[model samples]
Structures are given as structure tokens and as C-alpha cells.
Target chain A: MFEHLSIQLIMGQLLIGLINGSFYAMLSLGLAIIFGLMNVVNFAHGAQYMLGAFAAWFLLTTFGVSYWGALVIAPIMVAIFGLIMERLILRPIQHLDHLYSLLATYAAVLIIEGLMRQQFGSSGMPYAPPLRGGVNLGFMFLPWYRLWVVLFSLLVCIGTWMLIERTKLGAYLRAATEKPDIVEAFGINVPRMISLTYAFGVGLAGLSGVLAAPIYQVSPSMGSNLMIVIFAVVVIGGMGSIVGAVLTGYLIGVVEGLTKVFYPEAANLVIFVIMIIVLVLRPNGLTSGRGTST
Target chain B: MNSDANAAPLLQVKDLRAWYNESQALHGMNFDVRPGELVTLIGRNGAGKSTTLRSIMGIVRKRTGSICYEDEELIGKRTFQIARKGIAYCPEERAIFSLLNVGENLTLPPVLRQGGVPDSELLKQFPNLRERRKSRGTLLSGGEQQMLAIARILRTGSQFLLLDEPSEGLAPVVVKEIGQLILRLKAQGYTILLVEQNLQFARLVADRHIVIEHGAVVDTLSAEELVSDMGRVKNYLGV
Candidate 1:
């Protein structure tokens, strides 16, 4: 069984793992922030990711925009969509229990995915790689786009972590999560803060979708497929901990890749297995960072 | 300017009713606090002392009636909007962000008034907080957390402060220190509406006492009235 496992194969798979982990971290970070701030699970996050891909594709095909242009425009469009959703849909149900918001987002996912399918059809479409070349490492070949995804994603994850944990704006977001009323009583508009927070989280999801379009086919179901894995990452990382989500995302993605090398059969099931173990052992998640306040 | 006793009250609440979902908390509550006056709302656990403060701050959603601060009605306003109109609230739970450091928590509230107390001045007033500026809020003792909560609003330039049970669950010595802090705030000319179960602490600083019972104003007394009518305080508060 170990005979065919060469260094090149392992390194290649590790690269793939890193790319997947980058996406997991990005998506889960957004989820964690939204959950931390508003206590909403944001089930429509995947749909928003899909919308980002579609927006990029539309910019390229319809407006003759380049990958770079989509990179800038797509996330903003999706974020605006998220802002509308939050203000119109999520805000109304905000006073309800967390479960209702979760269900509402789940409903939003269905509506968004359905609309996309009707417009673009169910077939996957190819998105040309922006860099159009590969870099040959000592042991294996690395695609420029994949490397871009990894580096850019690392930058985003770190930047987002700093923004939330180390800045004055972040202080307001965290404080609002614990006690919105008190934060409001401090003369900070908490409802507006909450809306902007939701927009930011959804914007992150949109960015990930733009990054993912080149690697995976642009399709209606692409985000939904990846969403389950990202959810597993969020749970293992902990529901609302930013650092936990990022670290666990990369760790689990690599674990899944290694499993593919050692035992190909367990690759898909590996993340869920880890999630189950974490849930049983630490029900609050690996890092319980500042659980949401009612 | 601070000696405006003959002018309209700095803060006034009239027939303010509020509720949590369906259960009512403030039932036609009415009270007033003059500029530079330290007023305490004193009653037993369920007498709605806290509710009265929350209602005035617009923290409770189902509030009705009038809360006039500087003559602006606050009945339909959001808590943040009411806060911007020169009021701050320090709740009984302290409401400190467990994830934030002491200094961050101290300076968290955005300054609304031009002459809001600066962080340096607040740190001078709270020397312990200055020492523990980098410490996480959760690591602080109950006394320290209470200090952070109250001190947090000072820098926002809020002319009015609503403090709920600042001395609750603290050691007697800590309570004494808090009592002194209240006197210091009073001397600096900040109007205050304090909610407390501790009659002794109220007596130490408040110029007037408003007794609340079942979500309404049952009586009002000056420090002199309170001293003479200890039996009334004891009866209503059951302390």
C-alpha cells in the first residue's frame, strides 16, 4: 500500500490540501464572525459564495472584465446583496431565538440557489485561470493560481483576525455580541453595527467564491458542496472563535489530504469524523472564545 | 452653571411603563433628578429600581410615556440615541466585555460631548484600572469589574449616569471605595440616578432618594427625610 506513495504525490496532495484549507478557513472565518456578533449561523453563506462566483463570471462574460476586475467587483456585489438580506430578512427575525434565524437562512439558501439554477442552468462552467502558468518546486509542480489562493487567503485570514481582535471597531463588534443594549447605551449604534458586521462576513464568503472559481468549476452547487466541509471546520474550530476557525480549517484540510494519500476511501469522511470527536470531547468547540451574549 | 436647582430637572421620567416581552417591569414609574444631584432609586429585589433606570435609558424595548433629558423626550428612542443625548448606563451585571482589556473597556464608549472626561483623567480616578490596563476584563475581581463598568461611561461626556447596583456582591471595603468614587463623581457635577438595595451606600452620596415598589414611585425623600424615616426605608426595602 505504501509502495506507490511517492514524495511527489504526497507534496502534490499537500498543495491541494493547502488550497482546500485556504477556502475552509476563509468561509469558516466569515461564519465565525457572524455567529460571534449576531448569534446567526448564516446558512445562506454558501449561496452568497455561489453568487460571488456568478458575479465574477458575469463581469467577465458580459462586461469584458478581467479576473482582476472580478476579484474587486464580485465580493462587493455579493456583500451588498448580503446587506440587503440582513436588513430585510435577518433583521426582522433577529429578536427570535438563534434557531429561527438559522432556519430563515436555510430558506434563503434554497431561494438563492434555485434562482441561480434557473438563470445559469445546472451545468458547471469553466473559469480560466488568471495566471495561466505553474511553478515547478523541487519535488512537485505548483500552479500559480493555487499558490495565489493560499498566500492571498493567509493574508485575508490574518488581516480579518487583527481587524476583529485588535481594533476599536472590533471592540464594538465584540461588545455588541455580549450586550448590544449596553453597547447601544454607550452611544454606539448597535443595529447599524450588526448590519455592517453581517455585510462584512458575507463579503468574506464572496471573496472566497471569487478565489475558488478558477480552481473549481463555477456552478450553482459548488458552494453547497463545499459548505458542509466548512461547517465541519467551524464546529471543530468552535462556533464563534476566529483563531480556532482559521487554525482548524487548515489543519483539517491537510488531514483530509493525508487521508487521501494513506487511505483514499476515508478522505470525504475524515472532517466529519474529527468534528464528531471534537463535539463529544469539547461540546463548546476547541476554542470557546467569547460565546455570544443574549 | 451647575447650580441650576431652580431650572427644570436635568432628567425627568413621567408615567414611564415598560415590559420584558409580555411581563411588565416598569408600571407608570415617575422620578426626577436635578443637575449636580446624586439621586438613588432604592427598593427590594423586585421593586423595579433597575427597571426604572433601564426604562429611562431606553434599554427596555416596550417603554411608553416620557423620559425628558435636557427637555428632549426619550420614550421612542433607541438606547444608543438616548445615550448620545448625554446619558450613560452601568447595569448591575457590570456589562464589561470579557474579551476586551481594561483600557479598551474604559475608553470603549464613543465620546459624544465636547468636554467628556478623557481616559487619562478616568485612569487617575481609578488607579487600580490604570495598573490593570492590559488585563482582560474577565480576570478582574468583581470590584474591579464594577469600577470598569462605571468608569467606562465617564469618558463619553454623558452629563447623566444611571448606575444599577454598583456595590452589589462586593466586600464592604470595596463598597466603601465605590461610595467614595460616587462622592467624587458628584463633586465633579455629574447628575446620577443610582439603583441599589444598599440604603447605607445611598445615604453616603445621594442628595435625594426615590423609593420604588412594584415598578412605580412609592415615595420620594431627601437625605434628611430618609434619616428621620428609617422605618419607612426598612419597611419598603425589608433590609
Candidate 2:
């Protein structure tokens, strides 16, 4: 296997792996955050990501907003959308079983995807790459936009980690995750915190979509296509562990990429296989204690 | 203390009724706590002593009737709104955040008023907590968790405190320490409503004891009266 593979091929696949890993990390991180605090599976996350791409495209074409502007505006728009969804739909059903939220969000996925398909059609739309140039690093050519995605996502991940793990507000969030009523009794306005948290998580999904628009096609099915893989990533990482979600996402992406190079047939199957193995071996997940204990 | 006796009640509960879903927990409960007073709600397990505190804090949402704090009705207010009006609750379970370290748990509650006990003073008071500041909530012993629960609320600057079962599962020495801490808080003029199954512990720190049986106050006894009627009090506790 090694003898037939050139250094250039391996490097190219590695870069692709890193880019995919960045997406996995961002999507799974959002999922973990939402699940951790709100106890909602957020099935519509992929739709929100699609919405981000469409939002960016809409901004660019309809209003002449540059990619730079859309990059910031799109996620905010998705967050506002998420805020409304949480307040109107999720909040009322919050006290019900976990299944209710799952169904509700799944309904949202159908509705959002249906609306997008009706408007944009099933075909992929091309979004021009913000940075067209590539850099040669001796082994392979690296697209500037792809490099930007990896670095920018990594920065966002680090910043989120710091915010959740290091700050006083984060302490409130962690406490609320465990006991929202007690947190409320302490005058922290836990309901408002919960609403904002869900919005923030979906905002990450939107940001991921914007980053992916230049790389992958912006289509109605784009988010749903990635949703299953992202779910597999969340399961492999553990349901609510922030660190587990992020690290496992990147790890799975790279593993899948490597499989594509060595054995293309197993590329798609690798993540599910890993998920089964992880579930059997470490049922509580790799980073259990760092997340909500309940 | 005599002057505080004449001061208007800091909290007044009148015909307060609460339910856990379909089952009622508090039945026409009534009590009052004066400024600078340390009161204890003494009852058996499942006697709704804790629920009374929770009802006052608005944790039990199915509650009705009146919970007046500083003469303002609290029955309709949300928990956070009630909390904002200078009342703090330390739940029976301690409810510490396992993900947060000792230091974070110590300062988790927000200060609702101007006179919150400073973090420096609280750390000094609970020196053990200071030493294990970086350790997670699960790392603490039962007594330390209880201490952390009580200490955290002190920083809220809420003159009124509701503590549930602080000495429930602790060793004799730790229970004495908690009693001393309660006395210290009382000395500093912080009004507290404590729930205790330990009749002995109640006698140690409380100025008055409100006996709850079947979710209603059956008797009110001062410290001097409680000491004289030890046999009846122990009988009520079934200990």
C-alpha cells in the first residue's frame, strides 16, 4: 500500500482530511453544546448549516455583500432564527421527554429543507472562493481558502473552549446544565441563559456552513448529507463532552480521509465502525467527566 | 436580639399550599421569620420542611397562597425574581456543580445586594475549601460540599438565607462546626431559616423552632421552650 502511494497524494489527502476535520469539529461542537445544556438533539443543525450557505449566497447576490460580510452576517442570522425556534417551539416542549424535542427539530429539518429546495432547487449552487490563490509547500498545493477554513475553525474552537471552561459565565452554564432550577433560585435567569446557549450553538453550525460554501456545493440537501456523519462524530466523542466532541470529530475526519486513500471502499464505513467500537469499549465516551455528569 | 423581635417580619408565609404534580406537599403552611433571627423548621422525613423553603424560593412552581418577603408577595414571582429580592437558598442535596472546581462553586451565586460577604472572608472562614480550590465539586467530602453550599450563598449579599439539612449526613464534629458557623452568621445579623431533622442541632443555633407535621406547622417553640420540652420534640422527630 505504501509503495504505490506518492508523497504528493498523501499530503493532498491529509490537507483534505484537515479541512473535513474542521467541519466535523465545528458541527459536533455545536451539537455537544446544545445537547449539554439544553438537552435537545438539534436535528435541524444541518439545515441551519445549509441555511448559512444560502444566507451567505443570498447576501452576496441580492445585496452585493462580500464574503467577508456574509461570513459574519450569516451566522448571526442563523442565531436569530435559532433564538426564535427555541423560544417558540423548544421552550414550550422543554419539560417533555427528550423524544419531543428530537421530533420537533426533525420537523424543523423537513420544513427548512423543503423550503430551501422549493426556492433553490435540488441542484448545488456555486459560491466563488474568496481567495483563489494556492501556496506550494514542496509536497502539495494548498488552497488559501481551505487553509483559512482550518485555521479559522481551530481558532473558533479554542475560543469557545476558553469561554466555556474559564469564565464565571461558563460556571453558571455548567451549573445550570446540572440543575437549572437551583441556578434560577440563585437569580441567574437560567431560562434566558438556556435560550441564548441554543442560539449560540446553532450559530456555530451556520459559521461552518459559510466556511463550507466555497469548498462544498451550497444545496438544500448539503446539511442533511453531512448530518449523519456529524451524528456519528458526536456519538464517537460522547454526547455532551465538549472536548470529546471536538477531538473525536477531527480524529474521525482524518481517519476517514486516510481510509479513502488506502482503501476507498471503507472511507464511508470507517466512522460508523469506529462508533460501534467506541460504544462497546467505552460506553460513557472518551471525555465523560469534563461534561455534564447527568 | 430584643429589638429585632419587634422589627417587622423579614418573611411571612400565610396559608401557603404547594404540590408536586398531582400530589400536594405543603398544606396551608404558615410561619414568620424576623430580622436577625435564626429559625429552624424541624420535621421528619417527607414532612415538607424542605418544600416550605423551596416554596418560598419559588422552586416548587405549583405553589399557591402567599409568600411575602419584606412585605412583597412572592407567590407569583419567578424563582430568579424572588432570589433577586435578597433571598438565597441552599438546597438539601448541596447541588454542587461537579464540572466546576471548588473556587468556582464558592463564587457561583450572584450578589443580589450591596453587603455580600467578600470572597476573601468566605475563603478564610472555610479554610479547607481554600486549600482545595482547584478540586472539582465531586472531590469534596459531604461536609465540605455542605459548607460550600452554605458559603456560596453568603456572597449573594442576601440577608435572608434558607438552608436545608446542612448537618444531615455529617460526623458529630462537623455538625458542631456547622452549628458554630450558623451561630456566627446569626451573630453577624443574617436571618436564616434552616431545615433540620436533628432536634439537637436545632436547639444549638436556632432562636425559634417551627414544627412541621403533615406539611403544616403544628407548633412554634423558642430555644428556651425547646430545651424544656425535649421529650416531646424528640418524639416529633421520631429519634
Residues A38-134, candidate 2: write the lDDT tens digits. 9899999999999999999999999999999999999999999999999989999998999999999999999999999998899999999999998
User: How high is each candidate's interface RMSD, in Å?
Assistant: 3.0, 2.2
Off by over 4 Å in 2: A1-3, B1-3
The sequence of per-residue lDDT tens digits that candidate 1 reaches over residues A129-180 is 9997888898998989999999999999999988877889988887887878
Query: What is candidate 1's CA lDDT for residue B79?
Result: 88
- Sort candidate 1 into its docking category: medium
Worst 10 residues of 1 chain A by lDDT: A285-294
| Residue A25, candidate 1: alpha-carbon lDDT | 95
Task: Write one digit per residue (lDDT tens) for candidate 2, span B29-82.
Answer: 998999989999998899999999999999999988899999999988999999
Give the candidate number with the greatest lDDT. 2
Where in model 1 is the C-alpha error above 4 Å? A289-294, B1-4
Could you list the chain B TM-scores for each candidate? Answer: 0.96, 0.97
Error of 1 at B217 (Å): 0.9
TM-score to true structure, per model: 0.98, 0.98
